[model samples]
Target: MISVFPEVSSQYLIGGEWKTSSKIKEVRNPAKITEFVGEVALCSETDVTQAVDAAENAFKAWSRTSVDERAKRMKEAAEKLSTVIEEHVSLFVRENGKTMVEAKKDLLRCVEVMSKGADTLLEWWKPVHVEGQAQKVQIRKRPRGVTAVISPWNSPMILTFKRAIPAILAGNTVVIKPATYCPLTVMSCLKIIESSFPPGVINIVTGSGSVVGEALCGDTRVRTIAFTGSTETGKKIMSLSSNSVKKLYMELGGNDPALILPDADLNEAAIKRIRLGILRASGQVCSAIKRVYVHESRYEEFVDKLKKEFERVVVGSGIQPDTTMGPLNNRSQFNFVKELLERSKQIGAQVESIGQKLDSASWEEGYFMLPSIVTNLSHDSELVRAEQFGPIIPVIPFADLDEAIEMANDTEFGLRASVWTSNETAAIDIADRLEAGAVFHNNHTVFQNLRLDFPGIKESGLSQETRWGGLELFTDCYGFAD
Candidate 1:
């Protein structure tokens, strides 16, 4: 039996204080529907304006601080994050419903991303000079005024740090609006930085997207918007910001594909990549492998091996140490996955479930769905074309390499793609041809490095998020001559 903890009310962290409003929204634990994690303060337009005003006021002092000073504060925040790692990880699991192991890894990744931002600050401050015949010219990057950061619920803590840390490190004050479904972890992160940062450097507001997001985007005080969510929503954000033409950075949806070639290692390659792409975050990840195109020669064997691997996953409450998977974040997502699964079946795709279902008598309260695999899908089927964002992998077989690449690039979304092959030269050739922001060879798209550029191409997104590229995203160029 899982023990329930006392319910805690969540509040907005604005100007370094926890403020509450009369309106509140209930936050539920997706693993056990009986448990209420807490309620978040439903912020009003006044709340959003206050948060933005705080950020705008702090911009002067924060943007004037030396890069080294900002880097030091960021490093301190990262260290503080490490000290409370276990607490945050436990909270993430309870609130977001990822397994304990997955939660810990996500926290660790947040720490790493924070530290990377600190390192980037130091590197970005390096002096640059250009020699000229008559005079010496120098170029430097300066912080943009105020930034509005909007993150999604899939991995709230990590994405929050990914956007906020870099923006702050680059000398920009931020107003963060984390996803309503998972705001506690982000608030906790804000508390850590609040202790180190000034009162108005990092301001957080919690509310429905319709109310708060529109206010932030519509406000003229905001200079830039960094967002991560669905493509349709991104379009709406773009429309909202058009009045002021605020600079935008968006990482949207992906229908990532992993192609299995005839020369690939049948056992190690297929199982490893599939686990990372399909099983991680229970397939809530934007880069999760939604479709797999296998060479006709090894299609059956690959499917059998993948099914066996999928069977080994233990799904239950996230706190269980042995749990390899957990429930989806909320009922809406649960219903979305179920509806998609049913739609795939109706479209003539073969669906298979692995492992034993936990007793519904006790576990039925939660929004749980078994990890599923759909096979024999047509190249143009909805399951293959759409972004399911669930733990369901659709396997499609192709006769030739050209057909496989064509099918991989068939989707309207092109966030990421991968190829599993032993031939290094052939893999490189295929990687160049694939339409994605990032490509993996002998691996899946889940693998990301801080040094490389991270962004989607075409409809996927418009900006990159690591190294110097990320720092420049929050900066504006100025020129002066005398």
Candidate 2:
């Protein structure tokens, strides 16, 4: 049983102040849809203007601050945030439907990313000197003024902080718009972070994408748009920002693939890690494994192991101590995943629900779903092709390595892929051939290093996030000579 938590009322942060509006939108817990979580201000276009105005006014002074000073401020902010990261864990779970463990990790990652940004700031901004016979030229980086950071619902705080912090540390003032579905926790975290910055340096607005998104992208004062969402929304941002030719850094949707070669070992330990990669956060991660390609010789063995692993998943409220998996974040996503499973079955795919419900009596009341293992799916099947963004995954068999490679690269997205094999050399070869932003050997789902540059090709994304190359996208290069 879950205890009732106090309802949270969120307000817009503009010019270093919390501002409220007449228009209000209610937020409900996906784990218990009838339970009210809180309300947020449904900001209009006027609110967008005020936030951008504040950001634009502050950019001049912010951009002129010494790099060392900017880094110091960000470092201090990270230190201050670390002390209170644990306080917001429950609020995050109720608002986002992520397990308590995941929520804690997410908040801690926010602190880690901010600290890394401060540590790397000085080295990242050193001017490059170009010498010629005539004159010496120095190339320096300048911040793009008034960056609009639009973050997604899943892992909102970390994603927003990763982009917004770097943009601010780079000397850019920002106007942020957190996802409408789950904004309370993000808003709460931002309020703590806002105290570290000066007035107008960090501003936030909450509203529908149609009203607020249009305002920010269409505004001439917003010089850069840092967005993370669906590919369709990414396209709309590009079209809207084209008038001003704003610099765009987007990390969109992905249908990541995982390939298991015949020579690979399928032990319980390996299967557990694979299960976590597929079902973590109820498979809400954009880079999660949506499709699996197993060698024909190992298909039956792989399927049996995966199915057994799924059986251990416990579906219930995120607050439950024994719950391994939680509900979908919202009603629309729940409907989409349910419908996708039904349609896949209708088309002759074998979709089997393989998991336990913590409370069968109250199962239908919430947005809870069992982890499903799908088989008998063709390369072009809807379940195999689409980004389900749920715990359901399609495991397709391939006759040979060539067939596996061909099938994996057939998707419209290329965010991540992995190869499993006993031979390290063979794994590397297959990883090199796969079409994805990042590839792993023997394991999938985790990013080992954040400093490396990993930009997805095709529609997966533009630029990257939270490190050496990713931070560079928030600025512009200027060459100087005397």
Instruction: Work out the TM-score per prediction.
Output: 0.95, 0.96
Per-model CA lDDT versus the true structure: 0.82, 0.86
Instruction: Please give me the total number of clashing residue pairs in predicted model 1.
Output: 0
Number of the predicted model whose lDDT against the real structure is largest: 2
lDDT of 1 by residue, 373-469 (tens): 8987787888788888888888988999998998888877888888888898999999999999998887775546754556688888888855463
Clashes within 3 Å, all models in order: 0, 0
Give RMSD to native, each candidate: 2.3, 2.1
Candidate 2 local Cα displacement, residue 2, angstroms: 16
Best candidate according to TM-score? 2
Clashing pairs in 1: none
